[model samples]
Target: MPHPDLLFPPDREVRAIARELFALTRDLPLICPHGHVDPALIADDAPFGDPARLFVVPDHYVTRMLLSQGIPPAELGVPSVDGTTVQADGRKIWHLLAANWHLFRGTPSRLWLEQTFADVFGVETPLSPDTADDVYDLLSERLAEPAYRPRALFTRFGIETLATTESPLDDLSAHARLAAEGWGGPGGRVITTFRPDDVVDLEWAGWAERVERLGEVAGADTSTFTGYLTALRSRREAFIAAGATSSDHGHPTAATADLGPEGAAAVFERGLHGTATAADAESFRAHMILEFARMSIEDGLVMQLHPGSVRNHNRWLHATHGRDVGGDIPQATDYVRGLEPLLSRHGNDPRLRVVVYTLDETTFSREIAPLAGGYASVYIGAPWWFLDSPDGLRRFREAVTDTAGFYNTAGFVDDTRAFCSIPVRHAIARRVDAAHCARLVAEHRLDADEAAETVVDLAYRLPRRIFRLDRSAA
Candidate 1:
């Protein structure tokens, strides 16, 4: 499974240039400014359980494809909410994935998985019903080795720094431990990002309880609207103490509102009582985006707004399996009118850094690029979720470059929960960027030296600078 020319152009002259650019950036330390990898895994530094658990079970990208083709998640060892029925045998799960390998053809999941197998696990033979057991045994042996431990692999991955998302209620004990161990300090780094969706979204199930927990965590009286904002600000300060450089919002849309104190408090009262209407929920989320930006200005944490995914689209699956089980689907998102309120308030502020991500590709050229082009605070996020493939990556570069240009865009972030795929994901991104840059060189739109510099910026410099990851808070 050699991907020597995986995403490189077929033209020999163009590919030679791409290879040169790739050589310059292929081994740079990974800047995972945004992702969903559990910090507990890095803090605990434990050995991975088995091959199937490491590969198939935890990856929604892998499980979703299997589930889409009539395979129940239970059959693939994905635990239900109650843990009543999930495939318990690792070998059996591997066999199942092996039998259905063809389902991932032409998919990014397949490219990442195969690259991981070859590069990370040293597996050369293709996986299939025949080689499943052999591959499983080899992976089991490799995973048992000391180098395969979470912390060891963290170093092996050459990660300059990593950030994991957490709720406001999180105590950040793992981050504290990492800091105590000198991991999140000057040299080693693993920080947290504040994700307040559970408490901010009025329609979220258990929103009341999460807010109460937030009150306890922040030691604020959340019974009043003012106190709730205090609680949020307090928790954000706590996250900053734990080495957070950014705050994330996963709202359903890019909406923002600027209601004054009385109006905001009235909406908060309705939300606190669980009597808020659908419009109220939208209004509250919109208002909070503005508030989060204000907080970012005061605290210096970069703001990341990821919108447009309709989470848990399958109602039955959502009820049975809970969230992030590959049930989230992309929807069309409007950024211009939706973000007008917030942009009008803080778009020109040089102190604020807002990274905007969308699952909808349609918004890249027409809406997102233009917005980033105008606002000093806004930066267009990389192609994400459904648009993270090679073609998607190229399309993103093409779409946004014309308006936003390279500097107005944030560099690549994996946004993955799958740990082993980090290197492969970054490698693919580097290659795709090189290919894009080589084309610009070929067409004389950019000089070769300039393209080389741009490729490094896309790969290494921009993400570090944009996320403020280069700062030594400790």
Candidate 2:
């Protein structure tokens, strides 16, 4: 049997109320409007390879926690950019994971994994060191079956829509292919998001080469600043054609600058020549933020800014392992003065939609809620990264709901690499939201019927409206 402590809705008086609330929204169709799962998995529609690759490697949340215990990432099968072999044994990796599973107690990762194993795979036995091999063999055999393929699992999970992030240099052929073939019947919508961080940041390695490639793809000169901007614009249009509804920006800070035409051009030229100083590069990036805002206004794609991450904190790990392998750390961020330039220019515009996210939880009540509460274009995103857990979600609702309320906050986004955890994560969010609403109802702040309606809004409707997925035809 599964562990008694595995389930959420802890055994207490509150558990009864939480159970009722969970029942109301348990089977709601999942709307995963934003995430980081690869498009190729959905496009190819192939069965997952093995248990190790499926569970241990692709999930940075799991590996990062394991690394905290002195386990190297190479042993977890995190591939290098040049295609080096790491851990190859599925059972060994599973054993390692099971031994350290206690490290994830009370974490959302543990909750999602337990739910995926019990609810999806029907594994009655809890994952412990004793049962690791048995679970691995069972999962491996199941994954080889036809029903476990990406598209089939997507359908089985009741995922209405999934958006994958793509770089500006990406051709998006996979997304185009999925759209053309219609993977999920007549309207299999696997959309793309425009993430231009690699090309936008002047400090990134091979920035000039990526810019040249962007120009080549968009059929622009790219040697000058104007040409570079045109190339980026063209790429955005191409992504829009492939069924994108949003653009994502992951800047080091929320800072934005409103530079004059000449000043912007000068910075861009310096970037092209690779002669831009650190301050010059930052100024240019800030100017580009304004340009991105203007482009969002023109293109009608929602803008999402995820700031305050100090990516690749361990340079040696980055040198050996590369990015997105669980080395990124969060830092304190400022959204008031940082976002003033962009907001002053376009904050009142009704056509624009900008969702802001922060790793700095202090900003929720102090800065973000007020900023989004007043601005026409701004809405606060759900707590992300380190703050995506049950406790984090609860803290977020308690902190921001007073000022921002239900409307000013955009609903949940999985923001995960683990595909199987999508429904589980969303389910947890719905339950927590319902529990929060139940508290409000108990306090006589909101009626029972109103709480029910708001629960549905938080579960399904809010994300659709925020991400523009509620278009009449969709």
Q: Per-candidate TM vs. native?
A: 0.98, 0.95
Q: Scored by Cα lDDT, where does model 1 land?
A: 0.90
TM-score (C-alpha, index-matched) for candidate 2: 0.95
Number of the top-ranking candidate, with lDDT as the measure: 1
The segments of candidate 2 whose C-alpha lies over 4 angstroms from its true place after superposition are 1-15, 81-85, 183-188
Candidate 2: pairs in clash: none
Clashes of 1: 0
Model 1, runs deviating above 4 Å: 185-188, 472-474
Supply every candidate's count of residue pairs whose N, Cα or C atoms clash at under 3 angstroms: 0, 0
